[model samples]
Target: MILGLHHAQITIPKGAEEQGKEFYCKILGLLEIEKPDSLKGRGGFWLEVGDRQVHVGTEDDFDRLKTKAHIAYQVDNISYWRKVLEQNNIKILDGVPIPNFERFEFRDPFGNRVEMIQEI
Candidate 1:
């Protein structure tokens, strides 16, 4: 039986590497790890988020649109993340709160939905 999550991924259109890095690394502060040589030809990125991995892969003909699917990264200080998004010009959606976690959503540069969450 399955035990736990290994990694998660989102897609961006081709040629958005720099922009992906800017959003995932520069703003979100995730560490960029080198891709394996076997996957070097595939354009994308890998980020270290705590013990989890966030993969940003490229699609040849992807469209920029919002979707119901999203990746939520559990973080400390929801207020701090809000300011970071706002200061960087990323709009934060007023997300519905759950019993144990507070959350908000936003779109990445390529328009894939992402959510930031904090546990109370």
Candidate 2:
């Protein structure tokens, strides 16, 4: 058998799953997909964007202050995303320019780091 990258699961501290759903699903406009029936009791949510899927999991004892990894999304216009983030009160890090893309970073409500890149 062979395998390729299929999905990524992020663990959210304590009771932050609902916030994750609100941001990733509603704010980001990603479509939520129901988890398989056999895995119903597990706590999490899934979102589908094109062929990639992201899953956010809930953990009771996780510490919110700890440093965490993040996911990045490519956007058509960084300015538009900046406005959206500002409207939602999400803080955006000053962006740096790459060779062909401009990169901006931010953290989710639960402290999950995220980035947005737009072609320059």
Candidate 3:
């Protein structure tokens, strides 16, 4: 039988690892975990989200803003996140309403779409 998601991968422009860490680690408070030694030579980092991992890989010459693909983080308090993002000058986009859920979206510095959601 198939298992649950082990991790999800996202891309940022090559050589932007430090900037990515600033946002994903410092801003979002996601725990940074050491990548396997075998992958250390690669220009990217890993994050621990609960039991799962988010693999941030490096890529070049791609338009990230044009894509709707994103990761939706289920948070406990949606309003708190909205305020935090707004205070940081991140533009909050109204996400489509879904029954039993409140959510909003925003773009990271590299133009990655990120969503915050909480169940009603």
Please tell me which predicted candidate would have the highest TM-score against the true structure: 3
> How many steric clashes does model 3 contain?
0
Q: Report the Cα lDDT for candidate 1.
A: 0.87
lDDT tens string, model 3, 1-120? 868999999999999999999999988999999999999898899999989999999999989999999998989999999988898899999999999999999999999999999999
Write down the lDDT of every candidate, Cα atoms only. 0.87, 0.80, 0.94
lDDT string, candidate 1, 26-93, tens digits: 99889999889999799998998888788888996666574688899898899999999999898889
Estimate the TM-score of every prediction: 0.93, 0.85, 0.98
Model 2 misplacement above 4 A: 1-4
Looking at model 2, the pairs that clash are none
| Model 2 poorest 10 in a row by lDDT | 60-69
**TM-score for candidate 1:** 0.93
For model 3 the local lDDT of residue 119 reads: 97
Question: Model 3 scores what on Cα lDDT?
Answer: 0.94
Candidate 2 lDDT by residue in tens digits, 1-120? 757668877777656678888888878788999899877578787888668888888886665547657788888888988988889999889656678888888888877778888878
Q: Whose lDDT is higher: candidate 1's or candidate 3's?
A: 3
